[model samples]
Target: MEVSKKKPAAGVPAAKEPAPTLASGKYTFSKSEALRRYLSRKQARSGKRVSKAKRDEQKKKPKFVEKPFNKGTRIVSLKKRPNNYPCKNHSKPRSKVPKKHGATKVRKSLQPGTILILLAGVHRGKRVVLLKALKSGLLLVTGPYKINRVPIRRVHQKFVIATSTRLNIESVKIPDTINDAYFRRIREKRAKKAEGDIFAKKKKTYKVSATRKADQITVDKQLLRAIRPHPDRKILLNYLKSRFGLSTGQYPHTLKF
Candidate 1:
């Protein structure tokens, strides 16, 4: 910002205008007189915004320290508010464990490298490897989809069957499981990079045809054959046959993934 002090008539005092500081240098100048006014106004408006933001941020209540419970204490008495309850209402709902509904209890705990059969979802009954346990108590499993039928994704722990086979895959790092917010942030970042017509049009959707289905089966067979060892393939094949009567074609079968 530039400042101009107009000279007063002879023997009169010169007009006063302060010099621009380093921080308030974002002003646009068309004329010296306008520049001084613009900088002063802009600085004042910005300072007000900064102070308001800081004040609003400070207004948020901090998480209070949890104190030990004592029956004699007024805050902890059961007749009043208990020590376990929170003082403020949270915006998000608390997570709850689903009620047990006679679900089969597997004694084995799932671990990385564990091969599991998906008991539910689109890839039900297909074999997948547990890449890692997710933060949300779900299993991050993958079928190595390019080679196997199962696409990489997080699966509910309840819907997976822990198979006895555990292949060694500790060498690879599993990517983090993502939610909608993660993708939304990515889209916002990309939007900020360019303003108009920057994004490509969404691709069209299509229904699966018999030919696509046939091709998928062929791909799954080729991928499984190339990836799985002779012994492991034999076990998976036998399991599939026994579970679905694949050999006799007595039961309905689904697409591999």
Candidate 2:
């Protein structure tokens, strides 16, 4: 025997059931009274409602309450006086003046006559000789001006890279005149220009003072004398004259400075 399948009527169509939606737009989930009542009953059954009610009752209680004097009062007395003899705090407060900061620690690699490559500034990449550290915590260095044109000046230790090159300068004594005060630029007070000359254009020129020239000559003389006996004297002078820089294939990290 043969079997056949049945199909829907031609003029009719299938319909989909509508999903439930919330009436209020304030919340995504339903918060109907039935849901509130069910949650309240669940909390009550779980013993949370009792604790919440107790907290609310405690919040409603007065923090301080007055009582009748003789109802439950107890009598007490002090046997001796308390130890607050100096109650006004007569002691002095700590000093407000700040303590002076100690000098900057010199690096172990730095010493008199040690060559240092300056990292930053107008004369950066130039090598200079370490003379001594100033009381103000700055390094006193010089390029001997004759070799690299780097004058005797102060530089922060942080901005310098020490090299392995060192010269024996036991005989080279830095003069006391070359302290921090020596490099300070003294402002010469110019006499007020005559009213007649006020409009005249005058050119201003700066020259190295005789004192500075003399000092540089003195220091360089001693320094050169010490370097003269060294085997690599010419090489040392050339090294100080040349500027330090990295080429295309070179990197600072791999270089053993």
Candidate 3:
């Protein structure tokens, strides 16, 4: 009996042929060549030159991630009072001037017998007797000549005159006129007095005999311990010179002390 040949399956597709395997060969590479190849591949992978569009997109994205405030969060706010608050308080009706002994508003115009001290300005650190208070804000003085046209700004808060080595406020006086000429004259007189005092002391030094006999003097140990070269002084001076363009004086005394 003859039989028909079995038919192949209708839906099955043909399988692809396997690729041929490479033949085993002795592969060789120099150390430098192998390293160069590795480095080139690494650089090519890492150095991915970005396009401008990608960079712009990255920049447009928000950098920080914000979260909604939690229900438990608390808010606080503070407001500052204006600087004119005190002025407003003083304008109230009950703010009349008190009638106390030292509660006078005008301060009596700094009349004579009111000693005033030189508080600030060019005459700072000096004590002068106020002879009289001039209408032009000048001060007259018994010593150091009259300080012509001394401005009210130069006078201190309180004036006291030295009487018999005791300071008293009742003996002081105020002057009327304050002018450049008066100020110059007073300054000159003070300078002359200072010079005279200095010369007098120097002259006395020549006449005074030395009383101390030769003796071995011991140096203070504490002073020696403290007398180290300042570690920060050089660095600070250098910084000042570079930043502020300041120059130290040439005098050795000035440089150190």
Cα RMSD of all models vs. native, in order, equals 25.7, 21.8, 32.7
Mind giving the per-residue lDDT tens digits that candidate 3 earns over 157-181? Answer: 3443222211233322222333324
Off by over 4 Å in 1: 1-108, 175-257
Give lDDT for model 1.
0.57
Point out the higher-scoring one by lDDT: 2 or 3.
2
TM-score of each: 0.34, 0.58, 0.18
| Winner by TM-score | 2
Number of backbone collisions per candidate: 0, 0, 15
What C-alpha lDDT values do all the predictions have?
0.57, 0.85, 0.38
lDDT rank order: 2, 1, 3
Candidate 1: minimum summed lDDT over ten consecutive residues — where?
180-189
Over 4 Å off in model 3, which ranges? 1-106, 142-257
Task: Spell out the clash pairs found in candidate 2.
Answer: none
Task: Candidate 2: list runs displaced more than 4 Å.
Answer: 1-95, 188-205
Give one digit per residue, the lDDT tens place, for model 1 in 1-257. Answer: 88996667998887675654445575344478777777778978877435667778876645343445675423322234455965796689766977656533333558776777787887776777676664445676766564345655678887876766666554454333233222222222333444557456564465455643554454344435543664677665444333321445544344232
Worst 10 residues of 2 by lDDT: 73-82
CA lDDT for candidate 3: 0.38
